[model samples]
Target chain A: MRKDSRGFKIAFIILLSVLVVVCFLLGNAKGTIEIGVKRIFEVIMNDDGSTQRMIIWNIRLPRMILAALVGVNLALSGAILQGVMNNPLADPGIIGISSGAGLFGIAILVIFPQHQQFVTIAAFFGAMLAAFIIYLLAWKGGIQPIRIILAGVAVSALFGAGISGTLVFYSDRVYGALTFMNGSLSARSWPEVQTILPYTIAGIILVMIFAQKLNILILGDDVARGIGLNVEATRLSFTALAALLAASAVSVIGLLGFVGLIVPHSVRLIIGNDYKYMFPATALFGAVLVMLSDTFARTVLSPTEIPVGIVMAVLGAPFFLYLLRR
Target chain B: MKNDIIMEVKGLSVSYKDNKVIDCIDLAIEKGKIYCIIGPNGCGKTTLIRTMSRSIKPQEGHVFLSGSNIFKLKTKNVAKKMAVLYQSNATLSDATVRELVQYGRFAYKEWWKGSYEEDTKIVDWALEKTRLTDFQKRKVNTLSGGERQRAWIAMAIAQKPEILLLDEPTTYLDISHQLEIMELIERLNKEEGITIVMVLHDINHAARYADELIVMKDHKIFKKGDPWTILESDVLKSVFRVEAQITKDMDTNKPIFYAKKVI
Candidate 1:
């Protein structure tokens, strides 16, 4: 067991290194001229040296880091929710958390146009509210995962309708809000990265601290309590953490789909479901996948950039279908 | 008798919405004794056990463990006093047998302190006792039905509680596994001085294995005593509503039952 985990860590490090290099190369390929490898390397090594440094550090760096952070957040949230709910299908998207955040983001954009950060904050609170409602509605002495999913579906549909209604009523703000709703990284800047960094870091750290409790929770509430865990408290805390991560991701990068749902599930299949290892691994893989996807979306057409949201949907939908078939 | 009374449940009643599942049931569990609650399906046997373990709150009663109100104590405190093995055999995702067993030590350690040497010793002892040391590295999903049941038991034992509550521990096991588990429980009671309370469907097993037998009917204790005294044909008919013959086991001279006909 120790050997297997050690080997997985080595492989994960190699994959991460390769992805980092690829992201650096692809991210810089977009400017007036294709930045050479040596220049990009030099730009990273020496701060405040050249125009390449400004482009890499200021413009592309924040977006790249934001993409990575949001990816890790979504993936970890998805993995934690799936484990707590004990259902393979219980991703943030399936349970309506992402849509909840998107709807709230739309509302903020349409109703309070001056406060852009309010949209992100609203989305965060909205995701938490949705999760809380799901917990309360599904609870019959204790929260059951099946009931929670059912409640999530119902709440998600209601929010979905609310978003559409807002779009219809406030047509002027429709285009701007649509970009955020669809989950894009085009508008992300250093400020956006700074906004989400604290929450993402705290969320990841909290998950690590409670990793053992989560493993017990996967055995179902009754069994968890049998071994002395405060089952309801543990579950509520986990759901809140997941909601925070999901909300933070949506707030920064719009509503990226499938990263939260797919990355963690795939990791679990590869490395057995011990969350201490699973959580960090999922975070790394999620960050790498999103960074890579954003790079593709930005540089694919070069001059006419495709929104990262569209790129991910186009790529993720077929993989989702393949997963369903499996 | 004072030394024996390790756990006491007084006037315990549990309800879900408006429906009462367990109604004012009282029980006293003696230390170093194997006690079994036997009843037909949905007779509140499981509910009673859950209440005693504080997994489910009793609406109108108190559970006293070593003379303190169990409900008022912190969950971890209650857990240290007693451990329960629920009927559901749900496997955790990607949990190895060792990790699962290690969870039983959650109450002992604080948030910052990971598993300690003492925790490891207890888990190791439990795994050894349950004969699951060979399968420690295996994922819980990979285990057979009997192996999984033992794994759950190993986890409960790792808690090292004074009292153990098991709800239908042998429900899904084959006959050999069933006997193996019963013998393990019997040994734990005799050797470790741990009090045990269980709910059993098979009256014969309860009669043969348990030192004290409790027959619950209509959400109340219909009879409670030694299995020999309580496992009469009349009590069986009253609780299970079936006509049965009660006789002594040839080897152990314990009460044995054979249902003659369904009434």
Candidate 2:
């Protein structure tokens, strides 16, 4: 049975790799002008200055890469948060990481348009600050998931209020901030991908290295500590990493939810929770989920594309209900 | 610092809010003996064992393993000499038995390194000893309470600990399952020479298995001695507030008691 499960996990990983490739092809080929597979590969392999090649190079490809990176960052962040909180439902948004980032991103777009260049930095700072405060509120000589969740919900609501207050007063500037709030990827390109790429790389590497300790932690606190883990230390460091990954993705894409929730939750439901296996699997599948959903969002309304965040929320909220019922 | 004294608790106290659960307790744990702590509800049996295991930090004083202050040592270093089993095995993980057992090597592992041959061998030995090899593929949630309890013991023993502190290891199991767990624990103590300190609700089971019994009352040691000495009517009446009828087991020559009433 063990051998069977291992084989299945391996097959599932290979299948995910194939799906990512398929999404790349589907995403790149189905954009405006509808290039053929042969032409897509031709453009990818050779960068001639033709219009289709220019379209793929300048517009379609960067958005696809950024979507894929956002998928990775949010999914892995959710997976790490789940591990730290010891709840399969835990994600960046549960602890106000994304909300914090959204508040700051909106604040910059409306309040400090002059400092637009540092919007990503501001979002990242807000995410860390909110996460820090939540952790502080949760820690009463020891950390408990119940306390963290309660504190997080309160923190998220406060930051969410900050965002609404900003929007209510700056109603004239709401258009500029609306796309940021809705997590639109309309004009995102190479610069956006480059911004999020470092965090995705760093997050994946760190999670992989500490995967075993993560597994140890899910054994619950007494066992984790009895087995030699510094439970509080492990939880704090991993949670900080979760905030970092979520912040990077939120800084780029605005307030996207459910990529964090759905991808990791589904991956764990399919594959088991072996962290070593879960991390890579979630990364690949996160990329696939975002790419496919973003593709659907891009084409569903005939170029009147809704933000991917809207697509995710519409899909994610019900899936979350399904998870709770299960 | 005597060679046989495996652990020592000195002036240790623990409290939750205004209530002092363990009030300045002191005790010496000798090597390779099975010790059972028993008392009425809220008498601090659980807290005392938890403190001894270093899972609960006391507000005052120290618990010494060997001669060093246990709290002063790194948790991993403490784990090398002692292992603890908590009451509940509830977890969000669907990790299999072998996977759960594999983490017992965490105390001995390097994060960047692969767990080598010895780790696997020890894991295999723990599985074998606990008779969990057949069910090693099963998710921990799927295991029976008795089986899961054994699997937890398997994980603890994988540490090769010198002392095992268990908090009500057989609390909620059926009679047969409880005996199975007790017999397994007895085997671990007798064969491996692991000093065992456990909180048990069943005084009769404690009398049957323990080399010594520690009776607690009001967060302090009421009495502690051999079961034969500690299970007498007056002692039982004094500490447990119960009238006891005591007799010797014919087969094991161990004292057995039946509580008549709260007096």
Candidate 3:
């Protein structure tokens, strides 16, 4: 087990380094643009009256950071949710948090046009509200994992209808809403990154603090309670933290599905179920996947970027099906 | 017996929604003795055990552990005093034998304390006692039902509590495996000076293994005494609604019961 963990850590580091290089190259490249790895590094560092410097620093850097941040947040949230619920398929998007955010984002754009920050605020609230509803529905003295997922599906469908209704009614706002709803890293700036970073950081820290409790919780509620953990409280807190991470990710980048679900499950298969390793490893793996996927999205259709969510879904859906089969 | 009292319950009752699962009852468990509670299905034996272990709260009454109210005490402190091995079907996956055993040390561990030498030692000792040292690295999912039960026992043992409560520990095991676990538990009580309180469905096993027997009927204690006193034909017929022949084993001189048919 020790040797396996060591090998995983080494491979993970190598993968992360490769992702960084690929992200740097894709982010800096433009029309008929080709730059060496050494020059790319210098351009990122030097800021010496170079067009590459401007491209690296201003536009691509924030996008890359957003991609990494959103990736880590979503994947960690998924991992934590799976552990707390003790279900391999449990992820923020599948459990209605992402859909709720999408619905609220649409409502804000359609109804409250003047409040520009409405999308972010509404998305966060929507995610929290959806989670709260699931909690209440599942609470019959204590929450059950199957009930939580069922409630999530029910709530997700309800909010999903709301989103579709808004989209049909306000067709004129379709372009803006559609772009944001589909999840794009195209419009990211420093301010957007700054806004979502605190919540992501805070949520990740909370997950780390509660990671050990989550491990105990996997043994089931009775054993968890017997072992002296406040099982319900710990589960609720982790659920909220997971929602916070998902909501924050949605607020900044819109609905990026499958990254959260796929990254953590894949990591678990590789690393085993120990959350101490699973949590950090899932975060890194998620970030790497999104960084790589975003690079693909930008370069594949160069100058006209396909949404990163599209790339993720295209890649993630097949992998998810394979897992289901397995 | 009074001096040996390690756990005391006063007017304890537990309810689920409108239905009371464990009616008002009192129980006192002695130190270093194997006490078994036996009853028909849904007669509150498991619920009573859960209440005693503090896994479920009593609706009306107090459970005192070593003369202190259990509910009022910190859960970690309670965990340090008593360890519970609930029914073995509780969903756990992919955890190795060593990993599962190490969980018993959670209450003893501080937040900043990483897995230490002492934790490993306790885990090793538990695995040794359960005779699962060879299977220490095996995933819990890979173990047979008997080995899994032993693993759970190892986990409880790793807690190193003065009192151990088991809820239907031998439910799914083969007869031989059941005997192995019962013998192991009996040894723990006799040699390690740990108080053993268990819920058993089999009257014969209870009579054979338990030093003291508690027969619960209709969510209350119908009788409590030494197994030799409680495992009589009349008591068996009344509680279990079955005709039984009671005799003494010539070798061990313990009460042995053979159920004939429903009364």
Best by lDDT: 2
Error of 1 at B226 (Å): 0.6
Q: What value of lDDT does candidate 2 attain over all alpha carbons?
A: 0.87
lDDT of 3 by residue, A11-123 (tens): 76467667666664565553235666677679877879887777667777788888888988999988887887777777777778888888887788778878757677788
- Across all candidates, the chain A TM-score values are 0.88, 0.92, 0.88
| Candidate 3: residue pairs that collide | none
* Residues B185-233 of candidate 1: C-alpha lDDT, one tens digit per residue: 8887788877889999888899898888999988889889898788763
Tens digits of per-residue lDDT for model 2, B1-263: 45599999999999999999999999999999999999989999988988888888999989999999988899999898999998877887778899888888889987557468999999999999888999998988889999999999999999989999999999889999999999999999988899999999999999999999999999999889999989864777887787778988999999889888888
- Candidate 2's interface RMSD, please? 0.9
Which parts of model 3 are misplaced by more than 4 Å?
A1-34, A102-122, A140-143, A164-175, B89-92, B113-115
Q: Model 2, which residues run further than 4 Å from truth? A: A1-4, A105-121, A136-150, A168-175, B1-3, B112-115
lDDT of 1 by residue, A1-326 (tens): 36346577557646766776676567665554577777776887889667778888777777888888888888888998887767666677767888888788778888888888687678877887787777778877666767877898898887778877888899887676676656788867889898889988998799888898888888777777777788878877888888888988887777777787778877777776778778888888888888888888877787766777787778777866776677
Q: Ten consecutive residues with minimal summed lDDT in candidate 2 chain B?
A: B106-115
lDDT of 3 by residue, B144-225 (tens): 9999999988988888889999998998889999999999998888888899999998888888888889998999999988
Ten contiguous residues with the weakest lDDT in model 1 chain A: A1-10
Q: How many angstroms is residue A243 displaced in model 1 relative to the true structure, after the best TM-score fit? A: 1.3
For each candidate, the alpha-carbon lDDT, in order, equals 0.82, 0.87, 0.82
